[model samples]
Target chain A: MKTATFLNRDEFLNHWQGHRKLTRRTIEKFPEEEFFTFSIGGMRTFGELVKELLTISVPGLEGIVNKDDKPFSHDIELADKAAALKMWDEQTEQINELYNKISDEELYETFNLFGQYKDQTNNNLMYFHDNEIHHRAQGFVYLRALGIEPPFFWER
Target chain B: MKTATFLNRDEFLNHWQGHRKLTRRTIEKFPEEEFFTFSIGGMRTFGELVKELLTISVPGLEGIVNKDDKPFSHDIELADKAAALKMWDEQTEQINELYNKISDEELYETFNLFGQYKDQTNNNLMYFHDNEIHHRAQGFVYLRALGIEPPFFWER
Candidate 1:
């Protein structure tokens, strides 16, 4: 078997797209009320984590596209889920917009992330999807705790 | 002002339990058939991802617990979700087991993770929990695509 790697731009984008779709599904699984409820000490609430999903991408992508690394502040405290949902939708659009703006030459170059960690642009890009994948897993556990069934892992 | 810091053994374990409680919830959300499906190329299906999760921990912890770096080959494969869950439960036990075995000196010293990366045993130990957080996010997206509402994000 050949080495399994994501080398081309389209291939990478497909995975990212799939991830965005999957995260949207995670949002659907929540009742919306408890989606943002805080549980464990120091662990973020579902709503809070979802808020990070909304904020991190736009700013993070804006940073990556401009080659400037800035902190993506996470704010899950909101009066309503609709606003959070709307923000998440807009960021989703921004991710794709800024994403296509990146040049292949820049992809491999190291960029600073939140003033720490010398990050590779490609890896940072992957982190976009990878970070979502990380947080959505927490979403899954929350679903099960509510006795709700989440979607298939690979459906996206 | 407060300090941002790394987790200690007990802190890490609580995080693990918190993650695990959520993971099982995420798994419950998905249909078993698609658990291993990778909607995009180069991305592991959720099933394959689960297997990886099951296998990574013991070797990672054993590296610290036993002072050895073991590869992914072992009697257990993280691929089996139920088995992975079982193994994960077992590994958590093993983590507890190793926790008792390690000296304070060992906990503070650097440990190699199958040549993946090297850090203090404390960090590597925490890596185990970080891994779970990363993958669970994928589960969230999957659930959303299925049009299933997962439980609250903060149930644990």
Candidate 2:
């Protein structure tokens, strides 16, 4: 069974960054009130969605790099949308720093991600990406529900 | 510039297959009419979103394996939701066939995807996965708007 090389480190990081850019734009387009309160059919608001992304990426990566099995938790409470964005930027930098610690060899070695998802380091990274896009798409819907056009998906 | 190695071929394929399973579940959750007609904020309906995914993956992989540079086009005319699912399954088979042709050595080689988006074969493949997640997210939103609960995001 040959394993596929879907992305190298820099390319994967760039891919993640592109999605983050589009996600940030989605966050910006939300009206402050809707950011926290809007929901269609009992789904979470865009703010909550953004918080989920923030929670997963930084801590997940930290655990991967440190090999520390801290059960995943979003204990760090963000005050509001502004705080979320600031933390997003901070995590982006943190990702760069910690991501560098992962060598090409280590990417193939399986690690228990967040003490749960045991897969190759690279697969775990892709999970972070897939998770973000899933949430961001929800944000896109929230924008549309509010009669706002989202930044073009391709713009990322 | 450090490059990352994530999943080998089998792992990457499995990861993609998992997402496809979740996406298929999302499509199934949509009420037949809502799947085609429902939209939030003037966005493309779920049917059209599926069309975009169908348009890209198989052809993109075909081009990568064949080194064929044909401009991107949605030549397959899907008549309705059922037709889209049939085609979706067809493309899934097509992906397996074409994907198997791509040797690990070729994974690092750059391919011009859809006659644009020049990148390594691996990155191009990731684009396919990312684009699917982006569009599928929209479908999830559509489901929620229609008062339908989408499949769990982590179910993949």
Candidate 3:
């Protein structure tokens, strides 16, 4: 039997944070007035999507670290991009905090996410990363539709 | 120094293939006419986006595997969804072939991708995976806007 490791937990965290940084930039590029109202093809406004991200990260990590299960919610009132950016920064710190508390031994444990999705701790973390990338890509399209060039995808 | 390993080379390939499966399903769900035309927020149509993915994966892998750098191009004529899906399946096979050729020793070496964008072989591979996730996410938004429920993001 043989095993290989591409990246450690720390690298995974850094990669996730890189995506977060990119998402924050996407938030900065968005127009404040259109943040809540704009939608193309009936998709949720970027504001709604950003709010959902804000709702998830810290709360999700807290659930994993404290062994608590709570149903998922995306009902945060991010009145404007400024408020959203402020919380985004806060959650970034909270992620760093909660993420470090989970021992490596716990990395593979199955923790019920939002009392719903069940997966290893690592998969849940990947979900957070992937979900942000997914939404941020949509935001890129939204930005493009508004004739704005998004921050380079590779810059992160 | 402490080092931790999360996943091996084979797992990364499997994860990437999972996303491809999901993206194929996305193409299946799209209306035939809209495959080339449907878009939200001035973004490229799902057809156009899919073509770009097609353009990158196999050619990009071939470049890395054979050490041949060709400029990137997405001008392939995919007449319709059927043609596109067929080519996609073919490319998926090609990716498996090309991906396996590169030794683990070469994984961290930088290769000029498409005659531009130099990064570690692993990072380029990640770019392929992340690029697909990014585009597929945009497709997800396009689907929702069309009142179509996309294949579950997690199902892949």
For all candidates in order, the CA lDDT equals 0.63, 0.82, 0.84
Better of 1 and 3 by lDDT: 3
lDDT of 1 by residue, B1-156 (tens): 111121234544554676677877777676767776633223456676566676677667676676677555534444545765676677667766766576756766777767656766655554555566666665665565566666565566
True contacts kept of each: 0.12, 0.87, 0.59
Comparing 1 and 2 on TM-score, the stronger one: 2
Candidate 2 lDDT, tens digit per residue, B10-105? Answer: 777878878888888888777887766888889888888887788888888888889998887865687777888787788778888899899888
Residue B39 CA displacement from its true place in model 1, Å: 27
| Tens digit per residue, CA lDDT, model 3, B91-135 | 888988888888876786889989897888877887788889999
Model 2: per-residue Cα lDDT at residue B124? 77
Off by over 4 Å in 2: A103-105
TM-scores of the candidates are 0.51, 0.91, 0.91
Clashing pairs in 3: none
Chain A superposition TM-score per model: 0.86, 0.93, 0.97
Tens digits of per-residue lDDT, candidate 1, A10-112, equal 5456556676777788787777778667333235677877777777677777887776767767754666667766776777677767877877666656788
